[model samples]
Target: MTEMLAHELRTARAPISAHLFVSGFTYTGMISSWLPDKPDAACTSEETVSHLVERLEHGDFYILCPDNEVTPEIDRKRVAWAAQDIIENRPALSRWHPDFAERFAAFEKPDRNVEKV
Candidate 1:
């Protein structure tokens, strides 16, 4: 989808107190529609923003709006902050199997001698 469409969807909310039921099973974050009361009802893209705002005001869900458009500067800062967080946390890197450092270290080591018959 285009960036404009995404921005519009993010900004639209209506019904002044409707709950948006994002499917927990969906990993792609694509919603078919926003229901006013029934969770299964399909809502148009235009109706989503207003519906969301309404729900948020009624304490149905917490709304977190972006302060500004995602510019290059903002993107760069986000990446920098994420890198800093990772460095500070120092979480285990074992998940990245066959690590480059580990491979390089093995390659640099001298080969061991084997017994001959």
Candidate 2:
């Protein structure tokens, strides 16, 4: 996942949920390899989150959707919420709507059929 994280990013906001929306997104990958737990896991999660937060606070991720009013501040808030869930090591799986979970699962497929938003 670090490779994905390290992928060139546009001059946009934190993109906190970008990975989640992407297919094959893994929590352990966005992290640095120097944190805790088994040697196979962990990374600079703090630094990454901090940097993401900085961009998030600046409304770089601001967008409009059926569930949102398209405000930069609101986008930042949403990003913050998602980031905190990761920082606290919370299992967000149960919190996501089943529809989203299905979508994420489909992302792993070679011929994904999800439509562009």
Candidate 3:
């Protein structure tokens, strides 16, 4: 919705470039409430903003931020799967549904869908 708004604003008003920064789990006050100590999996606020700046400078329209635990490859796969869910008309968040659990697991496996020619 934010992306759509950005697009509409750009179209209706000025020629502005919309850069959406999708952040991952960051070591912030919210996390502090859950965990006393910042986990190794979470990225610092500075790190997260740094990544955003880097991607913004690179002229990325859709920026998917990654934390210590989640790599870029995994992020891409998850995003692709989410898009597919809409395209395929599957259940909302079918990835978490018990019926699709095995399929989601298989989808997460590296090189699972690669075809050998």
TM-scores across all candidates? 0.23, 0.26, 0.84
Clashing pairs in 1: 12-49, 12-50, 13-49, 13-50, 13-51, 14-50, 14-51, 16-54, 17-54
Candidate 3, residue 108: Cα displacement in angstroms equals: 1.3
Q: What would the TM-score be for candidate 3 when compared with the true structure?
A: 0.84
lDDT against the true structure, per candidate, is: 0.38, 0.39, 0.83
Root-mean-square deviation (CA) per prediction: 18.9, 15.0, 3.0
Q: Which stretches of candidate 1 lie over 4 Å from their true place?
A: 1-29, 35-68, 90-117
- Model 2: lDDT equals 0.39
Between 2 and 3, whose lDDT is larger? Answer: 3
Q: How many clashes (backbone N, Cα, C below 3 Å) per candidate? A: 9, 3, 0
TM-score of 1: 0.23
**Ranking 2 against 3 by TM-score, winner:** 3
> What is residue 105's positional error in candidate 1, in angstroms?
40
lDDT per residue (tens digit) for residues 1-117 in model 1: 334544455578523333333322221225424423433333344454554566566765333222223333333333344454376563344223354345333432334111110
What value does the lDDT take at residue 4 in candidate 2?
54
